[model samples]
Target: MHSINDAAGKILSSRQTVALTGAGISTSSGIPDFRGNNGLWKTYNPSIYAHINTFRSDPALVWELAFMLHDLAASTAPNEAHVALAGMERSGLLQGIITQNIDSLHQRAGSRNVINYHGTVDSAECTFCRIGEPVRRAALPVCSICGRTMKPGFTLFGEPVPPSAYLEARNLASYSDVFMVIGTSAVVQPAADLPFIARENGAFIIEMNSEETGLTNYITGCFIKGPVEQTLPLLVNKLNRRN
Candidate 1:
């Protein structure tokens, strides 16, 4: 891991800097980081909603996921890291943020250039109709039109990422000069591959995770081992001081 001062300065100096965030960034906000040994995936039986087969079998799983998501978003507020990243966007130091988190804290933090890779829980979509409709669940999910069923606007485990969101994230990673990966475990596929893709695209990789990850060995630029709340604010402050 590189020194914070050194990493922050250089990454801030980058012209077209961007970030790819994961659940670790929101763990502090109370949404448990999934995929860890005791994460949501491991502790709970996830077929309820995170899989296409389960959803097809019982559309109620979609409603279950939706309610859980609604409660999470309703409870967890954006933390310091989210605010700092939003500030970075406002300052023009960061071009955009691509997040794997389904929670919409980044939007609440006032981030403008954000591409949510996993869809959002803020809105629900009809699984049967697929009409790109907006249906909010005040209590439970019952589609007004088809009255079939509705689910969160996110990708299930067996489903592919949304093409529009995927393209936007890929484009940002491909063109970015500095790739800031914050608080991600970097174990998941496709989402984890973005940093490697960014490196292949001739960009500097700066990882800010609480501990070592699979990407650690490949980070030729910098690696800051600490929580995002501690690291991002300092980085933002470092950039703020430069002006």
Candidate 2:
């Protein structure tokens, strides 16, 4: 088992990397992680809010929940980890970022090659036609072009993953030389499966998590066991030094 600093060195040495991020990456930005005490898991059941079924059935709460989260997200900014990822992308080592988080922090940090597996919390769409448009936090966010209910451009639990986003994440993972899994426990489906696919296609797997994410065994590559904000900056600095 390598210490945090040693793992950072090896990560910066790798090329053709694809990052897999989870809630932990954004927790520093005031977003709540699901597993921790103050996380969503401790606060609410996932089955209640992860899908449209809950929204359609009880919309009052859906919008209420949205309002709260959106209000919170509005004030949050990108953390050091996010900036470091953007810096890595600028150096052209990062091929893409596969994130389970709905927060747009990675994109905001200037990373253009992000694959938002869970979709973003910003944009909205017409539920019926699936045509998307930007939405603001007005008293009512209705569609001007179409007369349909406007919902956030995210995958509700029962909904299928958006094809374009899903395929892009898989393709990047498939061709990556290194799959960097960060802040995720590796228990989630689909996104969890992505690293395995990459590994099968000859990608090295690196995991970073504070807890035992159940993936430490399969990933023979480096594991930086610390907070992302503390760890990613160090890795990015190492990458800067190598040149």
Candidate 3:
């Protein structure tokens, strides 16, 4: 088992290091995980609130959940884990961040090279004309171009992940010397497949999570068990000393 310091040292020495993050990373920022205890899924069915078909047929229902998420994102601040990653980017130890979250915390924390794999809540798209609109939390926003309701920019439950973000993330993972999986369960498709791509391409895979994930046993080169808020800062500190 490699120590966290050893992992940090490895990251410091690597030419390109990329991070893949999920809901767990934002939990410290007062956002709850989607599948954990007291998760949003427990109260709302994703089929109704999150699926693409539901958004097309009954957008109001999807907006109910969207409004709730908007409030949450508006109220929450970036946590230490988010800050640490942003610092790593500024220090040039990390190449980029590919996040499954739509909350925009990574951008808020000052990470410049963030790829939002699930899209962002800061804007929406008009379902009728496919025009983009800034998200307004004061009230539900309608499309100015077509007077149609707008859907959140995020990838819905049935919608495919955005092609450009997916391709860029894949390219980063393929060329990375160190690939870090942070707070993700590694169960979701497409995004989940990135670690395998990095592994196959000879990147050192690191897993940092509170508990073992589905990929813990097979894909990880090192597994550091702890909350990301605690573990990530420690890793960054170690990297700082080495730099």
lDDT of each model, Cα atoms only? 0.82, 0.78, 0.91
Please state every model's RMSD to the true fold in angstroms.
1.9, 2.1, 1.3
Per-candidate TM-score against the hidden true structure: 0.92, 0.91, 0.96
lDDT of 3 by residue, 1-243 (tens): 557987887797799999999999999899999888899999988988999999888888888888888888989999999999999999999999999999999999999999999998888988678788778875567899888878898889988998999899999999999999999987899998999999999999899999998888888989999999999999998888889
lDDT for 121 (candidate 1): 79
Q: How many residue-pair clashes does candidate 3 contain?
A: 0
Off by over 4 Å in 2: 1-15, 41-44
Between prediction 1 and prediction 2, the one with superior lDDT is: 1
Residue 231 CA error for candidate 3 (Å)? 0.6
Model 3 CA deviation exceeding 4 Å by range: none
How displaced is residue 93 in candidate 2, in Å? Answer: 1.5
In model 1, what lDDT does residue 235 have? 80
Q: What is the overall TM-score of model 2 with all chains considered together?
A: 0.91
Point out where model 1 deviates above 4 Å. 133-135, 138-140
The true-structure Cα RMSD of candidate 2 reads: 2.1
